[model samples]
Target: MDQTDREILGYSRYVVLAAAFSAMFIISPFEYAWSSMSGHIGAIYGWSPEQVALMFTTFIIFQSVGMLPGGMLRDKYGPRWTTAIAGLFSGVGILSIALGPSYPLVLVLWSVGSFFTGFIYNNAVTTGNKWFADKRGVMTGLIAGAFSWGSLPFIFPIRAIPASAPPETFFTVVYIMAAIIGGVSIVAALLMKDPPSGWKPTGWVPKTKAIARPSEHNYTVSEALKTGQMWVLIVSFVLVSSAGLAGMSNMVAYSNSFHFTATAATAAAGGIALANGFGKLTLGTLSQRLGVENTMILSYIVSGLFLFLTIYAGMNRSEWLFVCAAILAIFFWASLFSLFPIAIGHYFGEAAAGGNYGVLYAIAKGSGGLYGGILSTMLITQHGFPFAITIAGVMAIVAGLILIPLKYSPPIWKDEEAAAQLNARAAVGRR
Candidate 1:
C-alpha cells in the first residue's frame, strides 16, 4: 500500500457500513417476506402448493444468477450505479407485479426484480470487505444479519392482512415496500464512497492468527476459478446452505405440524428469523477467535444435531424443545453469510472480492435453493417431514466434513512454496 493510502481515512467507514446496512435492511423484505404472501397469492390464483413455491424457486435461481454480473458491476463501476439499478429493478418490477395479470407474467416480473435485488445485496455485502478489510467477518455478519432480520417488522402485518383482504390492498402494501427499498437504497448508494485502493485503518495492523489473512495474490474472477480450494468451498457452501435454506423455507409449516396455534407458529418462525440474524453476528465474531474453518465445522455439526433433535421434540410433543432446537439450527445455518465471504476474501484477495464472492454466493444459494426448496419439498411429500429433516441434517454434517480439507491447504496463489510447506505440515498433523 502506498504511504498516502496507509493512513487511516477517519471514521468514514462507519458511514459506508451504515449505508450498506440500510440498503440491505430495506431490500431484504423482497426475499424473506415472500412466505407471508405465498399462501395468499397461491389461493388468489388458484395455484397448487408446488406452483406457489415455484415462485420462490424462481426468485432464488434468478437472484443467484444475477450475482455474477452484479459483482462484476460493483468491481468495475462501484456500488452507486449497481445499487441505483437495484432500486430501479426492485422498485419498479415489484410495482409492476401488482398490475400484471397472469401468474406466469408475475413470475417473469418477479424474477427480473429479484435479479436486481442481487445487485443491491452483493454491493452491500462487499462493502465490509472493501471498506473494513480487517473486520470483514464482523461487518459482513452485521450487514448480512440486517438482511435476515429486516423482515421481522413486516411479517406480522403481512400475515394479519386477512386472506379476504382485497388483492389491490395487498399489492398496495407491496408498492409502498418497494418504494421504501428503492429510495433508501438510492440515497444510501449516493452516500457510499470506497476508500482508496489498498487502504487500511491507521495504526491497525493485520492479524494473521485466529483469522485468515488475504490471499498472497489478488486473484481476479477467472484466476479464482482455477484454484482447487475455490471449488471445495463452493461445494461445502452449497451443501450447508441447502440444509439451512430448506429449514428456513419450511420452518413455519413444520411448526404448524406440531399442532402449534397459528399465532405460535408465526411467532416461532419469527423467532427463528430473529435468531438467524444474531447467529450471523455471534458466529461471525466467534470466527475471529476460533478461526473461520473451526467455527464453520462447529456450526454445521451443532446445527445438524439440533435439527435431528427437532424430530425428537416433535415426536414427544415438546413445543419448547422443537422451537429451541429449530432456532439454534437456523442460527448456525445463518452464520455462513459471514464465514463464506471472509473465506473468499482470504482465498482470492480483496481486489476481486466483489466478483469472486458474487459468483460463489450465487452458485451456493441458487443450487441450495434447489435442494432446499424443490427437492426438500419432494422429500417431505414422499417420506414425510422427519425423513426430509434427516436428509438436511445429514447434508449439514457432510458440509462440515468437506471443510476439513481447507485447514490443510488454504488458498495461497502467490506463495506456492509456503503453501506447500503448510499443506505438508497439515497432512502430517492429520495423521
Candidate 2:
C-alpha cells in the first residue's frame, strides 16, 4: 500500500481505482455502442449512412482534441471539478439527443458531449498512471478495459431495439443512458484524486533491470515532443488506432454486408465488446512480464492477421468464423489503450503523464478518427468493405513493424552541463 496515499486520503488507492473504473465505464457506450444505436438514429432521422458516419467522426474529433486541455487542467488543478463539470455536460448532451432534434442539432449535442467524455477519459486513465506506478500495467489496464466492456450492458440493450422501433423507444434508452453517465460521473469525481507528487507504494523498490522501467529523467510535454521516439509512437498509434476504431465503428455493418442474420451480427458485436475489454486486461498484465514493446509488436501484428482472416471469413459467408475472427482482431487491437499509456509513463516519466500522453492521443487518435470514419466510409462506398478492411489490416501490421527498431535509452543531452541540469530536474520531481 502507499502509506502517503493512505495518510492523505484515509483509504486504499484501490478506492481511487474504483472511481476511475466507474468513470471510464460510463463513457463506454458513447463509442462502443454507437454502431448498435447508429442505425436506429439514422432510421429515425432519415439520414444517410455517410451522414451518420460523420457524426461519429465529429465525436472523435472533439473527444481526442479535448483531451489536451483536459489533461493540462487536471495536471495543474486535480480532477474533481473538471470531471464533475464534464460529466454534467456529457449527461445533458445525451438527454438532449433523446429529444429528437434535427440532424445538425444532434451533431452539435453529440460533439459537445464527446468533448466532455474526453475530459473524463483523460482524468480516469491518468489517475492510474499517476497513482499506481508500481503496478501500472495491471492497474491501468483494468481501468482502460472498463471503457471497452462497460458498453456491454448498453450494447445488448441497444441491439435489442428493433429496426421498426419508434423514436420513443430510442428516447427511453438514451434517457436511461444519460442518467447513468451523468450520475456516476459525479460520484466518481468526488472520489477521484491524485497521489502526493512523489508517492509510491511502501517497501516496494523500482527494479532498475525491469524491461519497461521508468526513465531516469522526467520530460515535459515539449521535451517529449522533441524526441524521435515520441514521433514514432505517434505514427504507430495512428495506424493501430485507425484500424481499431474502424473495426469498432463498422463491426455490425461489416457483419451485415455479407448478409449474415441479425442474431449473428449482434453476437459479433457483443463478442468484440467482450474480447476487446478482456484482451486489454490480459495483454496489459502480460506486458508487465513480457515488456511493453514486445507485447505491442506481437499484439499489433496478430491483430492485423486476424483482421485479414475476418475479411476472408466474411467473404466466404461463414458466420461463426466471421464472429471469431472479428473477436480476435479487436482482442489484440484493444491493448493499444493500455500499452501506450504505460509506454508514455515509462518513456517520458509520470510527472507530466497527462499532458504528454494527451498530445500523443490528440494527434494520433484525432487523425485515426478521420481515417476510420470519414475516409473508411468513402472507401467502403466506392471500393467496398473488403478494400477498406484490407487497408486497415495492412496498416496495423505496419504499425507493429515500426516499433521493432525502437529501443529505450536515455535522451542525448547536448553537453554534460545540460545532462546535469536535466537530472537535477528529474531528482526534484522524485522528491
Candidate 3:
C-alpha cells in the first residue's frame, strides 16, 4: 500500500481495536450493579450492608489475582486466546449473578468472575501500542474516552428502582445483563488478534525517543525490573489505582453530601464510568502527542484537584459544584488506567511486558482491599467523605509528582538502520 493508504489503514486498525474493546466492555454490568441492587439484595437476603459490600471488594481482589494468570496467557498464546476465554468466563459469571442461591455464595461466585474483567481492555492497550506506534498519545486519549463508563449503556437494563420492584425482580435485571454482555463479548473476542510482527500498518511511523533500533530495544522482565522506569511505572499505576478505588467506593456518599437526590447520585456515579471512558479516549490520544508520562501526570494532578472539589461541593452542597468534578474524575482515573499499559510496552519489550505488568496489575486488587474497608470505616467513623477523599486526592496528586520526573528515561527503540545491524549480529550468533 502507498504511504497515505498505510496511515489510513493504521488509523483504521487502531479504531477497530478501540471498537472491539468498547464492545468487550459492553458486557461488564457488574460495576453498575453495586448501587443498582445492593439495597434490594441486602434487604431480601437479610444480609448486613457490610457483608454485601464486601462482595465488591471480593470481586476486585479476585480480579487482581486473575491478572497474573491473564497476563501470562496474553504472553503465551497472544491476546485472542486470553480475551476469548475471559469473555466466556465473564458470561458464566454474570449468568450466575442473574441466578443466585445465597447472597454470600453469589458474591463469592461473581467475584470469581471479576478476575477476567480486564482482559479485553488491557489487551487492546498492549496491542494498540504495537499497531499505532506513531500516534500513541491520540490513540491513548481515544481509548481513555471510549472506555470511561464502558458499562454505561448496560446500566439501563439493570437499573431497578428501589421499592418499585420485588427483590426477585433482580433476576430479570441479571438476565438482561447476561444476555447483552455475553453476546457482544463473545463476538469481540472472536474478532480479536494481534498484528503480526513486521506488519506495520500504513501511514504509521515507528517513532521512539531512543537511539536503539526498534528490534534491538529488548528489555526482558529481569532487565525491566532493574530500571527506575519499572518502579516508576509501578508507583504511578498503584498510587492512581488506589485513589480511584477509594473515590469509587465512596462516590455515592460524596455525591449526596452536596444535596443531590438519590436518582442524581446514581446518575452521577454511572456517569463517572462513562466519563472515565471518554477520558480514556481523549487522554489516550493526547498521550500520543504529549508523551504518556506527561499526559498521565496531568490526569492525576487534575483528578486530585477535582477530588478536592468533590469534597468541597459535598460540604457546600452546590449543584454545579461536581457537575465537572465527576467529569474530571473520569478523565484522570481513566487516563491512568488507559495509558500506563501503553507506557509499559514502550519501556519494556512486549515479550516481558506481560509478566512484568502482571506483577503490577495483580497487586492492584490488594489496594482495593486496603482502601475499601479502611476508607469506609474511616468515613463512617470519622464523620464524612471529605477526610477519606482528601487522602485519596493527595495520593493522586502524588502520582503526578512521581511520574513527571520520568522524562529523562531513554526511549525503548531506535530507527531501522540500527535495528538491521543488531539483526545481522544475531544472525551470526545463530550460525
Off by over 4 Å in 1: 1-11, 212-214, 414-431
lDDT (Cα, tens digit) per residue for candidate 2, span 1-431: 45677787888789999998999999888888888988887788788999889988887889999888888888889889989999988887677666555777778888899888889988998877798888888988898899898789888888888777778988888899899998999999999888766667777676634433534566789999998889999999999999988888998999999999999899988998899888888998888888788899999999999999989998898999999999999999999999998888877777888898889989999999998998898999899999999999999999999998775443443454487798999999999
TM-score of each: 0.92, 0.94, 0.83
Residue 35 in candidate 1 has what lDDT? 63
Candidate 3: tens digits of C-alpha lDDT, residues 1-431 = 44432354444564556555665455445554455555556666677757766766776677667766776677667676677677666766676665554775687668666777656545555555555556545664555444445566655454535566665666776666666666666666555555544444465555644311224465656666676767777776777777887777556656766668776677776777677677777777666667777788888998988888877776677756675686577567777756776677666655555565666677754564556544454565466677777877888889889886677654443454477689999999999
Q: What stretches of model 2 exceed 4 Å from their correct place?
A: 1-3, 211-214, 408-431
| Cα lDDT of model 1 by residue, 42-92, tens digit | 766687778777777777888888888988988887788888778778876
- TM-score of candidate 2 against the unseen true structure: 0.94
Ranking by lDDT: 2, 1, 3
- RMSD (Å) per prediction: 3.8, 4.4, 5.8
Instruction: Specify the poorest-scoring 10-residue window by lDDT in model 1.
Output: 1-10
